[model samples]
Target: MTIRLAAVAAPFGRDLDECFATIERLAFRARSEGASVLALPEACLGGYLANLGGEAAGPPALRRDGPELARLAGIAGDMVICAGYCEAEGDLRFNSVVCVTGDGILGHHRKVHQPLRENQSYAAGDGFTAFDTPAGRMGMMICYDKAFPESARSLALDGAQIVVCVSAWPASRTDPAPDLADDRWTRRFDLFDQARALENQVVWVSSNQSGTFGDLRFVGRAKIVGPGGEILAATGVSAGVAVASLDLEETLATARRSMGHLRDRRPEAYAAGF
Candidate 1:
């Protein structure tokens, strides 16, 4: 079966209402385009700007069981919506990606690797997990977590055919000005996407935040990569949605021809190292 997927780019600093409006618009557009699932950028609901003072000063804007979830559930009818939000589980705060369908909230993934200023605002998740859905077995990782190959590999091993990544990657220069032939700004995440796609042989769908938030500007290269490391659809540096249709049968064929990594194992050698 062919599953239509949408990678939605969300601009920064948008409030919940504004974000919902944007999502509704995107959802409508996706539905028109025959998309079954829409994936929104990281921190799409509240904003990616981590207010250090705000986390400590007062209560969070939306808790996991708050009205926001109900609103999201309502917004997401039959189409599956995978979006990012701050999840508060009692005293523990986590940067989380939630999947909502008409049935209500389907799954929640807490980011395992927190980067830079996020360490101050969110706690890292302990274990990797995936959820079975009508579309397929879906898995999620937030922003910086995608940089690690093990994360996607873990999801692929868990029978996930498509892995969705929600990111608010900052355009702030982490390195000094370098002389490069190509655009260095995009190279960082591009390599991550290619590596993850090639290694896992699973469709990698990444939705990133665009525009500026405070001092940080977001990188807006949202894209979908196929199991063979081919770019299925890509959104340039702008706020828009990129849609692509993925075939599980094709992915299974690729996996079978490529020695079926899931079936072959060298785990004993790796475990011996541990």
Candidate 2:
């Protein structure tokens, strides 16, 4: 079966209404293209403006069962939607991805690898899990998690054919030296996406936040890569969605045929490295 997917980019730090309006427009476009699911940028709902010291004073933590989730669920049609947000559960805060459908939120993924500023605002997730959706078994990971191959590998091992990544990657960081030049940065970013797709033999879709947040600027290179590490579709440094059609059965066949490495594993012989 063919599944159409979309990756949507939105500016960070926008209000809830503005964000939802953007989502509505993107979802409409995706639906027009017969997309079965649309994946949106990280922290798109509340903006990525986290007040570390004031998190305790912020409004009560929003849960998957909250009004916001219900509102999103209502907006979703037959297509599935995935987006990132800050989650509050008791005293702990998490950087989370919510998978929504017409029925409501299907499942949530707490980011396992917290990056620099995130550690001050959110707790790390303990484990990874895949959620069954109308299209296929879907898995989620946030920005920094994409740099770790194990994250995607775990999802693939768990039977995820499509892995969605939502991210608010900083455009530039003052503390971490200057940002990599545009060409270098783009190459590095695309390499990671390609690596994830090739290693897991699964489709990789990423949605990233765009525009400047303070001095930091987001490199909006949202894209979809096929199982063999081919770029199916990509977006520029502007806010938009990249739509592509994916055939899971064909992808699986390709993976199995090229998995000579999988059949020739020597894991037991490599214990000396450990």
Question: Model 1: runs farther than 4 Å from truth?
Answer: 50-60, 175-185, 271-274
Clashing pairs in 1: none
Model 1: per-residue Cα lDDT over 1-274, one tens digit each: 9989999776845467887888888888998999888889988887875443334532244687789988887888989989898788777778888998978888889899976666777778976688887788889899899877789888988888779999988664555233321346667777788778777778888899887776566668888888777888988767888899868777657656857656776787685633
Candidate 2's residue-wise lDDT over 107-221, tens digit each?
A: 6899999766667778899767888999898889998898887788778778887899998776444333243336455566778888998877788898988876644567778
Clashes of each: 0, 2
Sliding window of 10 residues with minimal summed lDDT for model 1: 174-183
Taking all chains together, each candidate's TM-score versus the true structure is: 0.90, 0.89
